[model samples]
Target: MRRVVITGAGTINALGASVAETLEAMREGRCGIGRLDIRDVDRLTVQIGAQVRDYDEAAHFNRQQIALYDRFTQFALLAADEAIAQSGLTFEGPLAARAGVVMGTSGGGLNTQDENYRAVYEDGKNRVHPFVVPKLMNNAATSHVSMQHNLKGPSFTVATACASSNHAMGQAFQMIRAGMTDVMVTGGTEAMLCFGGVKAWEGLRVMSKDACRPFSATRNGMVQGEGAGMFVFEEYEHARARGAEILAEVAGFAMSSDASDIVMPSKQGASRAIAGAVSDAGIPLESVGYINAHGTGTAANDKTECAAVADVFGHHANDLMISSTKSMHGHLIGGTGAVELLACLMALRDGVVAPTIGYEEPDPECALDVVPNEAREARVDVALSNAFAFGGLNAVLALKRA
Candidate 1:
């Protein structure tokens, strides 16, 4: 078995295209969410989202590749490229065979699916795009990453609804720890800003009419978001031996399911996951510095998650700094865990906890140090990132400052 550490990280969301920009926005307590204007907001009750505006796909991909990739893959590939570049890795040497790619995405090629579905169903078209399979496949992003980088060790995709990214990263961590691979690119990508995709989520009737106020009494529901986040993970010895720039060490991970409801989440599931992760890391509960909560700003999620934390940590829950990044980037769904992981890493590295943007109104059920709409500077040794999905899937990962 080997130790795993993060060497590089990158992300593209409503906040910005890179980690630095995103962290800066979080530090300043900027809300990236706004009214949805891509098409129109005539029927949807909630008309706002944390949409990634002003991105040029051509700059990231060539004409041929651009035609084959959906919006989410484009974002994923771009983030992966930045991470690989920052890590200073090459396709030559043993790195080619030792490296792998792992990604999580809920609607892999939703934009492509919606377009082709409309063509075949609405227009009654005789023929559809021949490249649809390659474009719309859930594994397309992982396949493209392997092809682009010539990585042959392991390549796959994980789909666990909103917990997809965390599961992917956690799986990657286990693989590295067990010596399956030396280096891996793990993260998530999502593109649910499209009309059909957004409409599908609208059926749940949880869209925030105005904003996402996680842990707040006035909290309504989650807002749609689109983007990707990636991280380069390498075995600790391998990274140190090669003089790689170490960012943070992936300490522990745990996963569980409620097995009760599809939409409603459970505090017991959340409680078990936090305890499991803490136990897996071999760290006391008091060591956890900050938590990147799965605070969707929904009525059920905020309260349930709060109760779970309190149950697991007791008085330590009040002492810890917690925040919901979704208040700004909205919820990225399958790709959310990856972005939240970045928040965890940043918190551990800089010892500064980002705020839960748009947090207001005291919600007694969710009473905690939510870092309300303002970043706080503090000393942090370990950080936790949580992802609880709609189907009761929960994945938690802990990171130690390196």
Candidate 2:
């Protein structure tokens, strides 16, 4: 089997626009969750979100491109541009044919769908835009990325709720490992911060009114976030031959289904995924020093995730540092695993653990070392990023320092 390593990474989240800026925010334990600046805010009970503040669509896309691209596709392209540029790679010749793109998004072109639906139903409009179908499809982001970068091999999209990105990335890793592709442009994107987006989630009653305090006893619920995280996963030999700057190695990836609950997380399922990733990586459980948890700041998720980690790592769970960046960036849903993976990269690349911000009082159920409220400096050799989605889907990725 071939080895896969991350050659480049880029993201645009509530925290920052680039990997460097996001890492700095994590280092300072900054909180990006706040009152959202989206349309129809007055109609929803959950008014706050980790939105991409001060974003100017005109600045990123031309008029014709804007008409064709939705907010989610625009985000994916922007992040992909950054990742490809940072990798110093140009997909040309055979490389272009051998590379591929895979992105995860739960609601593609949600903003477009919401606007068109409201135009006909609420505003009594007769016609909607012609590009709606192309913009709103679940595979839109992946298609756009593939076109932009000239990737022609094994391109697709994943929509497994919160685990979408992890599953997408896991497939990309497997493709490279099996020698199907030498490189893959993969990650996740989300732009579901529109009126219809938050309104739909409000009915579920799992949103926090103000802050997203993960692992805290006073936690309320998850907060929505918007953006994209993109990476260049290259075969280890390919990256080394090109003299690319290796960020971290994609050690292993594993996925599992609970088959138990729809909304609630299952400890057994999560544990199996965690253990599967560790075993797939061929690393000892003791070597994993950090975990970017799927800590959604909810009572059930936090408690269940902690228990799963404990079950998987045994006594080493206490010694490992665990934190939920959702406390800082809110939940990006399908795109979350990709964004949270940035925290794992930070640990392996910079020896810094991103803290679980907004944490206040500790809960006995979540008694692990959360690295609460403050970033800590530590030499982390291995780390894991966990993502458990709404419908009992779980995915875990293991990483090692380069």
Candidate 3:
């Protein structure tokens, strides 16, 4: 099996617009969740989100491109541009045929969908944009990424709710490890902070209006965010041969389904995925120094994930450093795991553990070293990224320092 390594990473989120900026924010334990500025804000019960403030589409795309690309697609393209540029790989000849894209987005072009829905239903419009169908499809970002990068290999989109990014990246890692593809442009994108998007989530009654305080007893609920995180996964030897700057090694990945509930999380299923990832990586549980937890700041999710980790690692669980970056970036839904993976990379590469901000009161149920309210400097060799999504889907990725 070919080893997989991450050669480059890029992101545009509430924290920042690039990997460096995002990491800096993480180090400072900054809170990006704030009052959202979207259309019809007065109508939403939940008015707070980690929106990409001051984003002008005209600055990034021309008139035609702006018309064709939804906000999610635009974010994906920008992140991909940064990732591919940092990777320093030109997709041509054999490489072009071997490289591909796999993007994860639950609500592809949701902003577009929201706009068109309002037009036809509320505004009583007869016609909509010609590109509405293409823009709103779940695979739009993946298709556009493939076309832009000239990748002729396998390309698809995954939509397992919050676990979408982790599942998509896990598939990309498996493809490369099985020697089926030499490289893959894999990540996730989401821009669902629009009026319709927030209104829909408001029905779930799980959204926090002010802040997301994961693992804290004072936690209310998750705050939605919009962003994208992109990475270049390359064969280990291919990257080494070209003298590429390796970011981290994709050691192992595992995914599982609860088969138990749709809206609630299952500890057994999450433990299976977490344990499976470590076993697949051939690393002992003690070797894992940090975990980027899927702590959604919800009553059900926070305690469930903590119990799962406790069940998987036993006594070692108490010793491990675990933090939820969602406290800082809000929950990006389908694009979350990709952004959270950046926290793992920072831990392994820079020995900096991101904090779970907004943590005021600690819950005994989630009694672990959450590194609450402040970043910590600790040497970490291996880290795990956890993504437990709606419908009982759980995905975990093990990453090692390069």
Superposed on all Cα atoms, model 2 deviates from the true structure by an RMSD in Å of 0.7
Q: Please give each candidate's TM-score.
A: 0.98, 0.99, 0.99
lDDT of 3 at 163: 95
lDDT (Cα, tens digit) per residue for candidate 3, span 152-216: 99999999999999999999999999998999999999999999899999999999878999999
RMSD of each: 1.1, 0.7, 0.6
User: What lDDT is reached at residue 295 by model 1?
Assistant: 94
Model 1 TM-score, all chains together:
0.98
Q: Which one wins by TM-score: 1 or 2?
A: 2
Instruction: Give the per-residue lDDT of model 2 (tens digit) for 275-355.
Output: 999999999999999999999998899999999999999999989999999988889988899889999999998899999
lDDT of 1 at 323: 95
Error (Å) of candidate 3 at residue 226 is: 0.8
Q: Which residue runs of candidate 1 sit more than 4 Å off their true CA positions?
A: none
How many clashing pairs does model 2 include? 0
Candidate 3: regions farther than 4 A off: none
